[model samples]
Target: MNEYSLLVLATQYSFTAAFAAMAAGTLYFMMERNNLTPEYSPVASLCAMVSLVAAINYFVMKDTVGLDGQAASLAGFATDYRYIDWLITTPLLLAVLPVLLGRSRMNNGMMARLLAVDVLMIVVGYIGEVSINRAGGGTMTGWWCLLISMACWFYILYVLFAEIGRALEGADSYLKSSLGFLRTYLVISWVVYPLGYLIAVLDLSDNLLIGREMVYCIADVIAKVGFGMAAVSVAKRLSAMQWEARS
Candidate 1:
């Protein structure tokens, strides 16, 4: 347990809050445009609010929860259990979101790709959780989680980028304009996790005190900021497409 570790946990929690807020906003916007139905919008909003609440809880209870320790910390608990729980449940919920919200006229290929990616991410997340739990060593388990997470994230990023490109092919002005920013945001934001994992693998933290901090920072940024950006992007695209049909 140390001050640095506490700081790391606090940072992680803050990032989660930021992500949840963004997700809630995205879902709300999509609902307004009829991209997502009212029923599903409430669910998405609830999840987002939960994420923020969990983040706050972690931050507020950090010290009492042994968050300064390497093996037992608030951030560790969230990543090792809570976040994994969400990852597993989210895909199942999402599998039904499209059905409940009804389908858009957008490319089926893109939707299929996203669905596939979500499934893969859930599977990979489970694998990561299992691997880390089994490894049972600080650096060892962390490395295992980092590797699996990076792999899954990279795959997700690829799918998202490819789908956006496909959508841009003959997209209208509004859709294209929105996607241009979305693409850049996704590519850059998603890089944070992998970069952090790479740093961990290289064992560069020995020379750089900031290395450990970077690892937690990247994880938080990717999970929160990256996911938020994605939710917003998808919501925007779907909403705009619906509007185009009406007009």
Candidate 2:
């Protein structure tokens, strides 16, 4: 097959794998939600909903990139779908972090601030990517948006590591451990996004575009499925602890 065809196939398979991973995790969490602690039911449900969004996003994303392995025309809904997915799923994923942190610890104001940062990060990211690919607005505009998004990202990491990390010191040991896993997960797995943006958005070459999509697909599976599975484990542990206390 030609290089373009190969790239298309790779993208198709990669996103398909992501969809499967997310969808499977969704089902698993939903099925087991009843057995979890009452507090954890919402966590399980949110995991399922987030994965469902990923699964749907993958199917829609297939059309965003043409068979030539480049981003398709922006005129169609397909090109805009990525932003839509982020609009929905990004907040959900961020919400999971604070929920796990516990409302009493995080407080409403802190949650709102964190979520505002998350929204800005995603929105700026979307603007950067769409401007690069669709706006005909030149690379500088997109780069500027990307730079702003990066600043927001650094702020988020600071909160997680410096602020929340400090707060976790007096928390339940199990919660501290689980939140640690989440912090590590965000740093290690979510970092792929900016890297992918640099790869595809900077150059916009066909090959580089394909590479970007593949990178994103891989990151999606690892972040969503991996994060959800890890959360499930934490929920299970929390449920056991709660059960022990009651018994």
Candidate 3:
């Protein structure tokens, strides 16, 4: 196979791996959710939903980069697929924060605002990506689109780091430490998406255009599945505590 075909196969297999992980995560979250207290149940459901949505999305994604390692399918829907997945799954993933932090402890309005910004970030980023797609390369419009989206992304970082990370009043040390790692995980995993876009915007390398999809596949698994696993574990602990207190 040629280089393009190899890249396509790599991307395709990466998506398959993501699909398998998410599918497994869904089952795991669903099973373990029953072990949590009712108050902590929402996080489990949200985690499962995030995995379920991405799992289905990745299953379809397996088709977009083309079958048999050809660019036969990446035409109309390819650009929109991931954004749609993000539109649905991102909010759900973020919503888990408020649940984990406890609604009483978190600023509901601020959290709501953060989720709104997250949605806008994805929407505008999608617009920018579509512009790039239509141009078959970078464009001035795409640059501005990405810049605005990055602005939104910075706001999200503020919310995550400043708003949510600022307080942990009733949280145990274990949970506090988990959130710390999760915050860092968000920092590490979430940044890859925009950087992938930057690779395209900068026109860094032709190979990266194909390779970015592989990067995204890896990031999605880490962001969604890895995050879900941690969230569920935390919820399980909290539930056990709640159950013990009741006893």
Q: Count the backbone clashes (under 3 Å) in each candidate.
A: 0, 0, 0
Decreasing lDDT order of the candidates: 3, 2, 1
The residue pairs in collision within model 1 are: none
For candidate 1, write residues 1-247 as lDDT tens digits: 3345545445445445544554454454334434443433443453354345444533443333343324234334333443443454344333322332334424566567666766565555455545544543235555665666666666656655665455456555665665555546545654554454355344553324233443444454354434444554455456556666879
Model 1 residue 109 CA deviation in Å: 5.0
Distance from true position, residue 64, model 2, in Å? 5.6
TM-score, model 3 to reference:
0.92
Indicate whether candidate 1 or candidate 2 has the larger lDDT.
Answer: 2
Put down candidate 2 lDDT per residue, 78-134, tens digits, no spaces: 445666776787677777777777767776666677779888988888778777777
CA error at residue 80 for candidate 1, angstroms: 1.8
Candidate 2 lDDT at 84 equals: 76
Model 2 regions more than 4 Å off: 1-4, 63-77, 135-138
Q: Over 4 Å off in model 3, which ranges?
A: 1-4, 71-77
For model 2, what is the error of residue 68's alpha carbon versus the real structure, in angstroms, after optimal superposition? Answer: 9.3
Candidate 1 TM-score to native:
0.53
Find the candidate with the highest lDDT and give its number: 3
* Model 3 poorest ten-residue lDDT run: 68-77
- Candidate 2 lDDT at 66 equals 40
For model 2, what is the C-alpha lDDT against the true structure? 0.75
